[model samples]
Target: MKQNIGRCEFSQFPNLSKTICQEDDISNYVQHLNDLSSDFETRFEDVLTMVIPQLIINPYGDIEETDVILQAELIGISTN
Candidate 1:
């Protein structure tokens, strides 16, 4: 199985003062949020594809191994 983790960072302007600051730009902020959500979805799909197969093998020979594969298949449908 392959393990890959990615991190993203963004600057936040949480301390904007009304007297010294301008009003927030709604259009730009919405675009940024959409972009971030898309990036996260892409990264999650990549990791899920790698991890699900290894989890199905059940090296310890547990009976619940079958259930894991079923659940992974269901998750794959939604992710794809």
Candidate 2:
């Protein structure tokens, strides 16, 4: 996305003419993405605090033994 945005002219930016911000296209786009990421992090703070299972993120990586309940959840994931 960044590479594609970098290839575009500032004049070609979406809503570039409408936005009141004084920043350049690249800076504005970066700030927009940063804001989106922050919003997602705030929205999913509970999921973040849940300590996502490592194997769910990386199937090939080593993982410590988890409780039976979590292991059941992992099995459910693997089955799908």
Candidate 3:
């Protein structure tokens, strides 16, 4: 999330910052947030692809959808 924010094109947000928030700019801001959220979702899915295979290969493999989700959360937290 930090990296996504860092990669934002600040020039596109001329009136937005810590000190100022323009009501007119609200739509643009929302669009940016939506795009960033989509990007992060795609990245997380990629992370799952890399992690799920290994989980399935475990000696006592008993992986479920919920297990994949939990593992993905741990992997995301650990990397950050």
Among these predictions, the greatest TM-score belongs to 2
lDDT digits (tens) for residues 1-80 of candidate 3: 33333444355445534444454565566678788888988989877666556544662333343366576665565467
Reference-based lDDT, each prediction:
0.47, 0.65, 0.56
- Candidate 2 lDDT over 1-80, as tens digits, reads 54445445446567753555533856787778778989999999998889776666786343246665666666666678
Pairs that clash in candidate 3: none
What TM-score do all the candidates reach, one by one?
0.31, 0.39, 0.32
Q: What lDDT tens digits, residue by residue, belong to model 1 across residues 1-80?
A: 00101111122333432224222544455567778878988989877667555445653343354476566665665467
Candidate 2 structure lDDT? 0.65
Return the TM-score for candidate 1, rounded to 2 decimals: 0.31
Model 2 CA deviation exceeding 4 Å by range:
1-23, 52-80
The count of backbone overlaps in candidate 1 is 0
Q: List the residue pairs that clash in candidate 2.
A: none
